[model samples]
Target: MGCDGGTIPKRHELVKGPKKVEKVDKNAELAAKWKYCALSQEKLRRPIVACELGKLYNKDAIIEYLLDKSAERPNTDAVTHIRGTKDIKELNLTDNPEWQGERRSAKGDRYEDIHCGMFICPVVGLEMNGKHRFCYLQTCGCVFSDRALKEVKTEICHKCGDPFQNTDIVVLNGTKEEVEKLREKMEERRRAKAKTKKSKKSKAAESASTPSEAKDDTEVDEVRNGSLENGDESSQSDKAGSSGASRLSSSFNGGVPNLATSKRSIQEMEEKSEAFKSIFTTHSSAKRTKDQTSNWVTHTPYHF
Candidate 1:
């Protein structure tokens, strides 16, 4: 159909074409990944931390997130794998001496350097500004550029001198494939720890069961012997009063004499020496008179 104003209709305008794809700015994407916290979306500052998935975050932001997980946040997916502080490691970053922090352009006359980074790789001196690939050691938390690691082959950390394995290296701000691999490794490590704990608990249970089983057997034997002894004592009960009383007392005391009732005091024994009897605190010589007794002193604040 022609327009009411009598303008000719173009073939291109008659039919709608396919929508053009929207492209993201590379510089802006790099700045977001390198200079900001993935969890909080705030500017990356000192005391930075990284998760098992190798995502960078501010330490304070991670703490705040852990304190109140139910609160509304911008990026919940970034910290879903982090259950506690143990899941993340604090990075031992090397400061860039050349890096002068963000200077505000008062009149838009000065040029702002977006490529400047606060930290640099200790090995090859590469600025970690999302232009170069950086990886951190899980064991030591020392960060180094991928190029430096490839050039200098060693099991120890370049900066901290701590020993680390190939598996301990986690790429910071890694790709989708790399993050997936790290997630798999994290799960594997957790599964191994859980298995070891279960094995230890099973071993402890077995050790505990063995001792109790042996104790039960000994108790059963003691009961059998006690029954036989009781039968023999019953036959001798009519023989004497002293023996019957001793048997009854022994039975009540687990086949042992009740020392409080049966045993006489050392002071009451006529055979004991007078000096030995006087040595006991309960003896008359050990008792203190009013004049000999020291003044009562209170050691504590409380009194009965």
Candidate 2:
């Protein structure tokens, strides 16, 4: 009721309605705070996008976002490119849409700026004013500008005035935990893929430069050696031919060589024994001839 009511009766102020109005206003404000203006979401590959977006974390975030959730919501635009040989029509009949990319200068959060930007950031900017935009990104070399740095909560680029289709807000659907987990998994896969590529590239380089490049299986044997009895023929032949060799060799079993060898050995030994006996007999005979020729009684004939 209004206090300035006409003639008949003075009306009281409606305290209750005003309180409700204030509550509504408060509620609207809270909702507006989280409201996102779907201005732009341009995408690019890391170094490629980093050049465009002003830092590395922003690049990494965009990459992680697209890889983890390829489905673009109403406010989002997708920028994906396929490198496979399969054509769009061949890949998926239902979703053959070749995705276009998006870009933003919301630039990124402190996460991006800290890794990509200048000497002073919002965190440090709060500490000191008049800070320039610079790269905290490991790759970003210099502070580029002070103007591009922006607050995520309040200030939005009015370039987003056109409502493409604002009817449905995604309601921040999906858990932050799931998103983070997805990001971690994607990063792991990316690392693994990169490592594999690096290894292959290194191998290729070595092969190109050095034709005799060693393979990874140098220590492994080609094939197992045969059993002791079935070793190389050369080794077997040498062992059989060595001095002090076994008389019981395979060839000696029933061979002409064995008979000849036995005969020759016996004949040689017999000849040596006969020659020794003859020498002894001849020496005894010669000694007897000398004894008879030198007889002392014959030399002195008349004495006896």
Clashes of each: 0, 19
- Candidate 2, position 183, lDDT: 44
Q: How would you encode candidate 2's per-residue C-alpha lDDT over 102-218 as one tens digit per residue?
A: 333454563322122112332323211122223222122222122333333222222232222211111111245643553464457558998999999999998786744333233
Off by over 4 Å in 1: 1-16, 103-111, 225-304
Residue 134 shift from truth in candidate 1, angstroms: 0.7
Lowest summed lDDT over 10 consecutive residues: which window, candidate 1? 295-304
lDDT (Cα, tens digit) per residue for candidate 1, span 1-304: 5587889888789989999899999999988998899988999998999999999999999999999999999998989999999999999999999777765445668776778888999889999998999999999999999999999999988888999999999999999999999999999999999999999999999999999999999999999999999988876775677777887766785554455676778888777799899777767776656675546743321211
TM-score of 1: 0.68
RMSD of each: 15.1, 21.3
Give residue 55's lDDT in candidate 1 (0 to 100): 93
Which residue window of length 10 is worst by lDDT in model 2? 87-96
Which candidate leads the pack in TM-score?
1
